[model samples]
Target: MKLVVQEFLTLDGVSQGPGAPDEDTSDGFTRGGWFVPFVDEEFMEIVDGWLAQADGLLLGRRTYENFARDWPAMTDHPNGAIMNGLPKYVATQSLTEAHWDPTTILAGNIVAEVDALKRQPGRELQIHGSARLAQSLLAAGLVDQLRLAIAPVVVGRGRRLFPEGSTPAGLRPVSQHTTKAGLSVHVFDTAGLPSYGIYEG
Candidate 1:
């Protein structure tokens, strides 16, 4: 199984709480549900397709809490229905205390655990809205693809998916499309060694 990490981010790279206002305010983030305005049926259609293609879900502890609390209750929505029924792999040390059902905790070594999952026969293991988990996966070269829904606006400051000193890899674009509402959805296949190019000359 290949691991695909997906994120809905602002042009400035803020990935925290793209759905609800009170979801994550730890960084004094006031713009939580910023991506809702740019979403249309076309955007949703693509998301639905990704959800259907996933063999399992990969999440961080905080994102697990958000989905565990909301997905099961969203039976009326198609995307929610799919999310509620999928098997989930969570990255956390406090596995014994987490309350998410149908989830397996990754405790010993992050790379080894995810590597084991990849060896298993499955469609694709997906990570959604988990910046920290995504970073770990990226650093280990375990992430096979990146699906980014880039919204138009830029929130000056917020928790970013790829923070400074995390990883400075370049993504090779495999597919992309800009929505009618100006949202750019880009699909990138993992490429060469993660490198940083700084101009000093």
Candidate 2:
């Protein structure tokens, strides 16, 4: 199974709370719902395409809990249906029981567990809105592809996709498209480690 990360980011790389004003207010992040202005057909198409290719879901505890609270009640929505039905693997040490159906707890060596999951027979394990888990995955070199919808907004203070101390890796852009609302959708294949060079005069 390939591991893919799908994210909605602001111009300044903020990834937190793109859905609602109160979605994720951690660290006093006041600028939420920044991506709402850019929601158009193109954005929805990209989101739908990601859902269509998902065989399962990999989530952090916070994201899993948030989904468990909201998605089950949205059975009528196509994306909600897909999210509720897909097998969800959560990486956490604190969660004792998961109320969400078809949830597997990945505790004790998360990287190894995810590595095992990737080796399993499946299409793609899609991850959404799990920033901390994403950092870990990137650090471990476990993420295969990254799909991003960059909105034209700048939230000066918020949790970013590539935070400080993140792994340095090269990314090869595989595809890109721009929406009328100024949202840039980019799909990138993960290249191994980054290379450095000095300019010679």
lDDT of 2 by residue, 92-195 (tens): 99998998888999988999999999999989998998988988898899999999999988879899999888889899999999999899999999999987
- Predictions in order: lDDT: 0.87, 0.91
**Alpha carbon deviation, residue 100, candidate 2 (Å):** 1.4
Give every collision pair in model 1: none
Q: After superposition, which runs of candidate 2 have C-alpha atoms over 4 Å from their true positions? A: none
Q: What is the alpha-carbon lDDT for the whole of candidate 2? A: 0.91
> 79-149, model 1: which lDDT tens digit per residue?
87668778888888885665556778887788899999999999999999898889888988899999999
lDDT of 1: 0.87
Error of 2 at 33 (Å): 0.7
Tell me the number of clashing residue pairs for each predicted model: 0, 0
Q: Model 2 shows how many backbone clashes?
A: 0
